[model samples]
Target: MAPTGIVLLDTYLPTSDEIAAILPELIGDMFEPPDGIAHLEQLRLTAMGRYFRMFGDWNPNPVSAPKLFVRPGDPLREHHREVAWRAGWPLPHHSADVGGNHFTMMSEGAATTAEAISRWIDALRH
Candidate 1:
């Protein structure tokens, strides 16, 4: 089923250079997966290799659907909101800034995120 609206929670749509810079770090993060996870390292390496191969030619297709960008107030990745706006993605009446960085936002700021989403959905239904 097609979604009526989308809630983007600190999503990253990286440029080629950004991908190149972060690819190694991403692979590093996948290392040392918990014990008993068979072939995890190989799987991560394979995926990273595939992503690297695709990065140079990557392009973000235009999205027509309404979107709500939930930005974290912490300042590291807040630029993502502007990126979405510049790409012409439609935003809700107000962009929500939950108080945590990208990773922590989901866990620490989950309530705020949920409330913002609920408000946006309620507004749409009205």
Candidate 2:
């Protein structure tokens, strides 16, 4: 929460430009489909829009439902873990990290992620 006690808002970040600019530097650790650069470019505005425009007055601080924060295990995304831990979700909040970059985690690491989910589900059930 911000000083106003509303949901914390980011006025400065969520720039796709910065991520696009740094892709080459992080190439070794990324997985890409055909025409990845073009795909990124095609998605720049829409991707940035979620933060750049749409989230002006949103509140997610009191997320009531159980939270399952499955984070992408990209080195660049390590902050996700810190954020999740800091968010301090409800008692049964669960989290895990599967290998791969954010997008790649959907493909290359999907099985691992799925297994993590299944385990979490089983744990909850038990």
Candidate 3:
């Protein structure tokens, strides 16, 4: 994105490897069509192809304004957090281990996600 404003990333993974890495977990965790694997294959292909086409390079770019990176609260899943930071994406000035996985953070953990984001923004305003 054209860096210009405040940002809140909920497990903002930007690479195919990141997507692929979590595929195993996602296979059974999501509500998909009977052809779940097929659907995921399409998603996987997009991560590998369409993502780069739309986003330019994998290189990290500078981001201005306040930033926050919130992730699933699962302690065992901490490695994703580590991987995220190492991707050269603009580092979040603030970080948190919130609730739910990458996708659940939007649905099952939507409330938690909202609260976390709200707190982040409130802190930024102060």
Candidate 4:
């Protein structure tokens, strides 16, 4: 989705450990190598024990602006989009299909996905 105001552009969320690891490749536009390193450092600063504990306590209730743009779109993307559409504002954009791979893209398709995003952003700006 387009950002609501002049300040925020989009939200980048990496939900699982595997996805987080591949995130640098998937969403390279958002950060430089240094930024990725910094994010890793920040993640390390948090205690793993505390992080694991939150899994059981997680709750579904929330009230806030919708976060947009989920990457590495797979079957799960459509599922979540359906849920979000029912709940409130549907997500604005999903990651490119990339030849339907749940795992990392295979060279040509990855480039295709990247190009798609570039075009999408350019279109949004104009």
Top candidate when judged by TM-score against the true structure: 3
Residue 116 of candidate 2: its Cα lDDT?
A: 75
lDDT of 2 by residue, 48-118 (tens): 55654664444335545444666555534454343322222223445676776555656777798778777
Instruction: Assess each prediction's global lDDT (C-alpha) against the native.
Output: 0.57, 0.47, 0.56, 0.37
Each candidate's TM vs. the true structure?
Answer: 0.55, 0.49, 0.57, 0.30
Q: Sorted by lDDT, highest first, which candidate order results?
A: 1, 3, 2, 4
Model 3 stretches astray by more than 4 angstroms: 1-5, 11-20, 23-49, 75-92
Using alpha carbons, what is the TM-score of model 3?
0.57
TM-score of candidate 2 on Cα atoms, chains taken together = 0.49
Q: Candidate 1 lDDT, tens digit per residue, 1-126?
A: 667777877544445333344444334445643222223466767875676576545655656666787776663234544432221123342466777654456776778888888999898789
- Model 2 segments more than 4 A misplaced: 1-38, 41-51, 56-59, 76-92
Screening candidate 2 with a backbone cut-off below 3 angstroms (N, C-alpha, C), the clashing residue pairs are none
Candidate 3 per-residue C-alpha lDDT over 5-124 given as tens digits, one digit per residue, 9 for 90 to 100: 354555334454655555554544433523212345666756745754865446545566666666666422456566533212346567766676555667667798889888877876
- Best candidate, lDDT-wise? 1
- Give the higher-lDDT candidate: 3 or 4: 3
TM-score-based ranking, best first?
3, 1, 2, 4
